[model samples]
Each structure stands twice: as structure tokens, then as C-alpha cells.
Target: MAAAAAMHISTEFINLKPNIWKKPDRASGSCCLGSDDISRKRKLPILLFDVMDTIVRDPFYHDVPAFFGMPMKELLECKHPMAWIEFEKGLIDEEELARKFFIDGRDFDLEGLKDCMRSGYSYLDGMQELLHTLAADDFEIHAFTNYPIWYNIIEDKLKLSAYLSWTFCSCISGKRKPDPDFYLEVVGHLGVEPCDCIFIDDRPTNVKCAIEIGMGGLCFQNAESLAKDLSHLGIDLSVPNI
Candidate 1:
């Protein structure tokens, strides 16, 4: 099994595929860098960004029950904390919960609910410009999020599909952040060593998890503060003010 796994990775590294989401002519280069090749080749730094509170302010209004035509205060006052606990554990789907609470309650319009959710979502200041700067510098930027198909909703609402090289969501992979295996899976998929990647997340535990797996990690506070921190780490983030 180990040998087969090695062979699979070897194939992925050798037969680099194209970035289907990007331009048809552009190729997804191998993520591996050998000792000899590392010296000769310009090592492209990979930046893994967290979604939600890291890149965007997670507005509470979006999750409010009132948006779904339910009593917000009443739902909050309910003593069933286990429901939220189960939700966080991925035992319950967000859409399904919304349907059970709101859609089945009355004349709930799915499109309207989506629009309200999107309207409450706001981008972090300077994020768009930061992304452009990183892309211009030839750095490979990707997103790692716990959000499920909700990433699709964010992509459509923010129109950020073009700025990112790829996005990995736990919903798609059946894996959650702060897990060593989750980070390892991403490294395996990218065909890169842990040392070649840098991950930025808002949560300290998540950052610590990445570090435990041998990847460089950054704890994000704000975009401005993060830019200063990245600059100290030799990353040139000279983008115009957003």
C-alpha cells in the first residue's frame, strides 16, 4: 500500500495537469522540488488562506434565525445547545437545518434567503488588492476552508473565483481543519512537502496544527497586521491601498 501510494504521487508530480478552473492554456506545475532542482528553479511560495473570519468578516446576521423568517431571540434562548454542537461537528447540514427550521415553517424563498446571506457577507479590507499583489508576484495562492458547498456561495457572491488557484473545502474532502491528516492530504494532493507550504488561519489551534505537521503557519488577526507580518517574513506585499 505504501509503495502504491508513492507511485501515485510520483505520477501526479511527473504528469502535471492543467488548472481546469483557470485558463485552458495554463498548466498546473509539479509541486515537488528536489535538492538539485530547488537550486536551479525559482521556488514558488504557496500561500494557503483560511476563509470566513480570515478573509471576510463573518457577519452574524447571515446566521440569524430572523433571516429565515424565524424568531431570532427565541431560537437563541432555546436550551438545546446540543443542536449547535452537532452542527459544528458536521453531523447536521446547514441547508437541511435551515429547511427544517425555516423552509418548512412558512413561505420561505430559498433565493431570498441566499441573497440575505450574501448581503451580510463583507470582504476584509485590502483582501482583493492583496490577492492581486500576490498573483502579480507569481506566488501560488489557495484557500482552505471548513465551509462545505458554502464555498460556492461565497465564490459567486464575492466573485473571487478568478483570483485563487484552487480551493479545498472540508465539505468536498470529508475532512476538517486542525487535523494532521487533513493537512497531509492537502500536501499529498499538491505534490509538495510540508516545508514548501505556508498556512494562515485565524484560529491558534489551526495554526498550531499546521506547524505540528511541519508546515509554516501564521495566525491572522487582520489583513493589515497580517501584511506587516508577511513582509517581515520576506514576502513582498506592496499592493496599492484598497
Candidate 2:
């Protein structure tokens, strides 16, 4: 498994299969990460938790669309199509992201936008306790999410690094979720087989990718639902108030 070492987020790029979401045929094999290179040893499964809606709700999802003077649906449908993914992949900085997003003549305040992205993150009640309990039980946990440069704000504000062995973001890895390379790289870095991991993400698509790679996956509805799924997976989580 990957050590709980100093967080080293690299900019290196390694290409793998592209993730096309429409009707994906699940790969049937040992792993999307070649089994020949993987260790045959069985290992305890690590929990890979997603951020944003999975842990911290994104304020920008609604606020940014409103700031652009459009409804959320319209904004998502016609807004800067590739900017968010590009931003998440670290291809462009925040200023560039804002510039790209506000291209439709909407006035953009960089600081105000930063505030929208940074503040009022409400962690699902008992989430911290669940993480602590999992840690106490000697379960390995890591933060895996698709977030942009401002991910640092939420990471610091929520103090996630204190609980997780490693926190990986698209901005840091330059590889977004649902991409096979992202999951493969994480497993490769940890020196573990894909089967030795269970992923929790808010999106079904993200979970699907992990499943295709032979990792157990759970779509997170809430912390309570997560507790139930973990219990089903034979992980005894003792989180009160959940």
C-alpha cells in the first residue's frame, strides 16, 4: 500500500484508455492495470473516498451559474464546455478558468468567485467520526476526487489531510476521475492490486470506472448510506449519530 508520506502531487502524464461514459462495456480481466505487473499477495482493501458532493458540497455548482446570470441547467449546457475539466486537470490556473467560464459577457470578480468556491463547506454529520473510527480500526483511507486548484482551500478548511493517508485531486495529478489512468496510477503508486481497493464517489460514472478496474464501488448517497454499504462490505464502522 502507499505510505502515509509527505504529499507529493506530481505533474507527470501517462496516457491510458479514454473514458467514454455512454454505455461503457465493463472490462473483463484481472485488471485494467496489467496483472503481470501486480503482486499476487492479497491485501486489505483501502477506501478511496471522493470529495466535493461526496464529502464537501460544492457551493460553486449553483453559485457560479447564478453569478453568470443564467439558470444552472442553461449554464451547464452551454457554458465553457472544457474549462472545468481543464481546470481540474491543472492544464490552466484559476485566473484562466474564471476567464474561460465568464466568456459570455458576465462580470467576474476573482475574489468573489474565490469566496464562492471556498466558503460554507458543510461536512456530512458524522463524517469526521467515521474517518477517525476507520483510522482507529487500522483501515487505510485516502481522498480521491475531481477538484480544481481551489481544492487546497477545502482540504485545509476541512483538515482532510489530517485524516487521510493521501489526498489526490485532479489538479494535483493532472488526471481526472472516470479516466482509467487515474485509478491505475493511484493503485500503481500504492503498489496494490485494483481488487485491494473500494471506491466511494457521489457520481455513478466515477464508481463505474473503479468497478471496471476490478475495485469494489459504492455510490455515495449520504454518510448514513455509506455506513450501510461499508457494513455490507464487512467493514465494521461504529459512527454514532449516523
- Against the hidden reference, what TM-scores do the models get? 0.71, 0.78
- Give the number of the best model, judged by lDDT: 2
Relative to the true structure, how large is the alpha-carbon lDDT of every model? Answer: 0.62, 0.70
lDDT of 1 at 19: 16
The candidate that wins on TM-score is 2
What digit string (tens of lDDT, one per residue) describes model 2 on residues 63-165? 6666557776666655566777788889998788767764374557878767766665668777777887887876778888887777778767888776785
Cα RMSDs, all models: 12.0, 10.1
Candidate 1 lDDT by residue in tens digits, 102-190: 32243356577567667767778888788777877777788886664556677877876667744577666666777688899988887
TM-score of 2: 0.78
